[model samples]
Target: MSAQDYAEISTLMQAYADGLYHADSKALRQVFHPRLAYVCATPGDELHLDLETYTARIDKRTPPSETGDARDDRVLEIKLATPQLAHVTASMALMGRTYLDLLTLQRTPEGWRIVTKVFSYVPMEKS
Candidate 1:
């Protein structure tokens, strides 16, 4: 992938993160494939879902009850597997805690879109 490809993908990922905090489904969907699958790892185990399920978790906007620093900090680390494939992982902090969101992406007719996402949460603070 050219630097531009990576840049575009990065931008889309950021858009998704911002959209999640803002609850903008339209923006959230832009970077995801139609058949996207998202898997989440909780304290107990990993959870999986398709696009519809993923959409349910995104909010058009953060609820007023949220008191922390915006509750949305998503960081992406991208590794190119090939010209058309890449492995991307997002480390997210909401209310100032780190969690994981792993994703696999492929270049499509439209552009690079996330085909799979895996999520995991960690302790709020370390001892």
Candidate 2:
């Protein structure tokens, strides 16, 4: 990613982490589209979440404590195609395990926003 792209991705990723940590729907709404798509693979199963489902779920979440479960150390490695479309992968440690969230973003008139995301942990094989 170019410096400009990197800067944009960093800002957006921070917004994502903040949204989850603070459980702020407005913040989340700024980073993602209302029609966003998501896939999360946890130990139990591979789950899919659409826009409305994710909105409802996020709306119901309790924000993490100030000092705990505040996701940090996000690293975004991005490859951009025309600066409008890019693939980004970021990692952070939440709870006791390291999780990676891969995001696909497309620049819209509003700005660069995530369109789809896949959330999963670093599998145990690496641990």
The reply for model 2, stretches above 4 Å from the true place, is 95-97, 122-127
| TM-score to true structure, per model | 0.80, 0.82
Q: Please estimate how well model 1 matches the true structure, expressed as its whole-model Cα lDDT.
A: 0.75
Evaluated at residue 43, the lDDT of candidate 1 is 62
Question: Which runs in model 1 stand beyond 4 Å of their true positions?
Answer: 59-68, 71-76, 95-97
Question: Which candidate number would show the highest lDDT if scored against the true structure?
Answer: 2
Displacement of residue 116 (Cα, Å) in model 2 is 0.7
Clashing pairs in 2: none
Q: Write the per-residue lDDT of candidate 2 for residues 10-51, one digit (tens) a residue.
A: 888888877767777788889996678889887786889887
Per candidate, the number of residue pairs that clash is 5, 0
Q: Would you list the C-alpha lDDT of every candidate in the order shown?
A: 0.75, 0.78
